[model samples]
Target: MNETAVTAASTAPAWLAAARAHANRPTLRMRMPFVVDGEDVGSVETVVMDRIVEHLPGGHRLFFHDAAWHLQSANGNATQAMNTLAQAMRELGLNGPWRNEQLVVCNEDGKRIGMIERGLVRPLAIATCAVHLIGTAPDGRMWVQQRAFNKANNPGMWDTLMGGMVSAADSLEQALERETWEEAGLRIADLQSLRHGGHVDFQQPAEEENNAGYMRERIDWFSAVVPAHIEPANQDGEVERFELWTTAVVHDHLARGEFTPEAALLLADYFGW
Candidate 1:
């Protein structure tokens, strides 16, 4: 065997060795579609990530949540997958104890608003499972947010919207309402939650393409479309700058590394682009 093969063999865990031997091994991985109110979550992974985003909103955390059903579907590699994930995370500079922290904070009631996944539950705003709110101008441009400099994970990166973790009190609508107000000054009262969009599809990143094991859970994806021009109040604390964009602009921006690799993968999968 070659040096790399010998090295990999030396470090191979017993479980993976067993898993790999079963060539016809069926990676029994899949997630139930997540939805809220009426909207269908287009991608489960994005929605789960969005659920965990947190910002201290005048003491109110704009909590997002993942359905337990969906949560159980992803990362089912069990101990073996975990070992591989840990090794990969370490090699990729995303390892460390801090990576396991939860991104969302629940209310006093301890409701399940959202959870931190990816071994480290980073938070995000923008509802993908239920009612989604997209910011745009008169044209068909999409508005995006540049993550603040003080941000730890994606500092200097841009996103579909800026959001934070919050308590899971009140209804999902109330949470979104609270999130909109917190991330950017906007009231979504009388807003409509888009219903029914699940069985989310996955368009994995290059590395994940052959990783059939990693794609078990289907991230139900959902997006909300706001009818009017959204003028979000700049919450300097949670956001950097906001700009309206066309699909073309977003396409280029994504290509230029404006969004995090994970976010980019999700956006692509969401639109099935």
Candidate 2:
């Protein structure tokens, strides 16, 4: 191999390490399966469960049984019950930053069970879905965004062109289109060579919540080519700014831990670095 190829081969491990660092799977030894209507939906840390039981409304029917936490007597209104519990938890300061958005809760088989507040997903260790878009300029430079400084999580970190949660009301396709427009001010139909880039599953402690919350997310990422004449403008105010960076510059930022872990994982997988 030539000198450049040798150097590239030597640095590939670092990229893999950076991505793998965010995939720490949770051990359920200290947690209990949160079951709804006889379906196990999530794994809640024991301490978090205790806090929830203590703060949940008196009318709620969440209880521990059969070695799992189960909601009893929801009467087909499990969504409402979960929302009530989530709101109560938030009121008692047991949840993460409240987004006032609802996320679909699903069982292991990906069956939708109910909906809960977005902020309570981590506290309850519920698996959530998100979409990320990776944009490349006509010259092959990647478009990255700086998160708003006041954001609740990973503030000021560089990220993929656009990334946002798949809200309860959106399908994967709808989320892709919506987040692209909201975060980048670019319509999906206007992009070139749009393609699905697979997904990455992340399970880690939510550092923003001081490790009191757990994050289990599946991020479906896509990539597209942005026309040179089109510039990305932030419409949602969640993005501080956007910059087009060469592959080398992105790699440097990844190595320096300047990118959010989720973004780093997707970018590394995209580049096969």
Candidate 3:
């Protein structure tokens, strides 16, 4: 890689980290009419984020992390506040930097209207970090199994080669490496080449509570094509079963709803048709 690419890549997280620092504070301001109680107030500049939460009497609550005059915010545009703070959290969670983006709310009439933040929420995806890896000479291929009948969500559905969750204190690569080692007995560096199948957020709507009760995470998808000469094996109980399948057979299973929706979509594209 050239020096420019290296420098840009190295500083990417720092930019996001900076954004997160300001995200919890009111460092951004823009004027837009706020829709409240069925009325569009003229050019109201609302606070999109603050680290504090202001509790109102009754079940009503306002996250003060993004602040503004109390009256204007009672029924203000929360889309911006929520999205920006979430973005900040995504960076903060990884101890990274922040970069400014549209922080969009939603798109309408070919125009984007919302806050100054990324306009989307990603699911906190949990999957096996990796499937195949180095070991004894490759014996055909290996089927990576995510312990069937999980105590949560899907109990016994086979998923793609790699999967995992992004913890509040871990970077994407760190989480992937840790999960791969714990679940599959392989380190991320062990596999030089990995492919991202895709990911899903799987979040629910917010409720009237202390926090929104929803976790947000943008899953970095992946796949590892280990040397055929090295066979991969299951290490922990998280994997209940293992079997080798040819790319064709895997394609067939993908056609039969056998993988995660995002993974299935990616696998479909991988198989081309």
The superposed Cα distance between candidate 3 and the true structure at residue 35, in angstroms, equals 16
Which runs in model 1 stand beyond 4 Å of their true positions? 1-132, 190-222, 225-229
Please give the distance, in angstroms, between residue 121's alpha carbon in candidate 3 and its true position after superposition: 10
Residue range with the least summed lDDT across 10 consecutive positions in model 3? 122-131
* Highest-TM-score candidate: 2
- TM-score for each candidate, following the candidate numbering: 0.43, 0.91, 0.43
lDDT of 1 by residue, 126-224 (tens): 122222334444444566777778765567787765343323233455655666676767666533343323333223221222221222222333344
Instruction: Give the number of the best model, judged by lDDT.
Output: 2
Give the per-residue lDDT digits (tens) of candidate 2, residues 1-273. 212223344436455674696577555347778887788877777676776776666476878888899875446778888888887777778888888899999989999888998988987789999999989887778899999999988999999999999999999999999999999999988999888978999988776774367789999999889999998999989999999997778889988889998998887667755
Count of residue pairs whose backbone atoms collide, per candidate: 38, 0, 31
How do all the candidates rank in terms of TM-score, highest first? Answer: 2, 3, 1
Candidate 2, superposed: residue stretches over 4 Å from native:
1-11, 27-29
Residue 1 lDDT (model 2): 21
Given candidate 2, what's the lDDT at residue 121?
90
